[model samples]
Target: MLIFYYSKGSSALAAHILLEEAGANYEARHVALAQQEHMDPGYLAVNPKGRIPALETRDGFLSENPAILTYIAQTHPEAGMLPDTPYEAARVHAFNAYLSSTVHVAFAHFQKGARWTDDQAAIETMRAKVPVNLAEAAKLIEDHYFKGPWVMGDRYTIADPYLFLLHRWMEKAGTEFAPFEKLAAHVAAMRERSAVLRALEAHEIS
Candidate 1:
């Protein structure tokens, strides 16, 4: 069985959802961030970066959502976790990359501004900018990426769960994600999935 290490509702949620969607026999282990359990020596041994959503395979553990997600996609092609064509496949990667590198960064700035700066004023500025910056990112996703139904349009790919993670955080941050009608619809549709429901229960996300 695959062992998945994750926080309640972090980036790990996406992979957790996909694992359920693929009907894989996997164990979901929660790394309590509130207790700083992720930084514990044992967990660090699992992932030196001390990050959540680390998956242990027979050979070793895999960190990073992009890598974990791709592994799940390739391992279960019949689940349709990925797009059909090469170009669309590239687009899927692009979408995930943007969510991780760009969207996630925006959120991190809102919550963990100290990671970027120590100056109290600067950190506050970064935190204060989250709404506008996140809104802009949402606009980019709304106007360009989402094409009705899914991130890749009409088909549910890995990017759906990935985007779902972002939207949840955005809403939690008081972004009022409903203004982006399409994104709101996308998030609503994704929330309706049994896989997502199961993953949420397994993860026990608040």
Candidate 2:
């Protein structure tokens, strides 16, 4: 598998960490979003949406980070990145949904623009709404399954890497994780994991 990504962003970071944690054999190809490489015709042909973190699998190309993560988890069930129980699987999906639909989109609108004509309004809206969504997501994580040092119970599942990446973005957004002690601790613990550390190092993140 080949993951085309930009290391500077959260989605790519999530995919990178997940691949590392799953012990998947994969190659990372850096797509320089800052240089607008994503807009090139070739890259756009690979992903018409012109997004980073596109996964090239034997079956086909997977674009969104959540889809790629789910595929990886499901493909390698022995890695224990996803839950076996139906309800637990739903909960994990819920977390990913909240991240994608809420936190991720919110940040995107704030950091990037929505429509050309609505950039200012979208930025202000995101600036106001993103914090609220992030806080709610963090609280839900703490209240629901923030046990045994992960988003899910004792197991270090796929959610940890995603949440960890989001936490780093939250810090950038000037939101303090202090309000969510459990989530904050989870981020710190995930940072210490050998796989996560190695992944970051391999990506030359920090």
Candidate 3:
């Protein structure tokens, strides 16, 4: 049994959506970030990093979106969540890596600036730049990473959910979508999926 530790409105949504998409038998444990449950002793023992979306497998706990996502896809091969080819699969990883490393980091500047610096003014500056940075990130994805209909073109892979998470973050951050038409269309398309709707409903997200 896979016990997934996740919180609402976090990047964990990506993995949560993938779990539903793959139709995995898992227990969803909500770690209340607002209540600081993540920092609690028990939760800390489960994940020293205190991060959401940690997977409890028979082997052990797996942290981080990319690793957990890959695990889900690999374990449930019939789901075809990943491409069989090496280069194509690497492309999927590359897109997800960009989201995790670049886009998510840009949003973190606004959401968790204190993690970066102690200066209040610097934190405020970082926060102020979030909208612009996110917008640019969206443009980068549209111009380079994103392929029409899905992140990896025709077949919907694990990267789609991560891309959808980016869209959700952009929407919540009030980042204008008028510029990235393909991304806007992709988000709309993702919303139509039964698994996507299930994940959104599970998270109590609109």
TM-scores for every predicted model: 0.96, 0.89, 0.97
Q: lDDT tens string, model 2, 64-172?
A: 8788889989887888888889999888888887787777876665467554346676567667666666667677767875675777778777777878867766776
Q: After superposition, how far is residue 12 of candidate 1 from its true place, in Å?
A: 1.2
- Badly placed stretches (over 4 Å) of model 3 are none
Please tell me which predicted candidate would have the highest TM-score against the true structure: 3
Evaluate all candidate structures by whole-model CA lDDT and list the values in order: 0.87, 0.76, 0.90
Give a tens-digit lDDT track for model 1, residues 58-150.
779999898898888888888988887999999999999998889988998878898888999999988888888888999999999898888
Worst 10 residues of 2 by lDDT: 108-117
Residue pairs with colliding backbones in model 3 are none
RMSD in order of candidates:
1.2, 2.1, 0.9
> How far does residue 202 in candidate 1 sit from its true spot (Å)?
2.1
Range of the 10 consecutive residues with the lowest summed lDDT in candidate 3: 165-174
lDDT for position 26 in model 3: 98
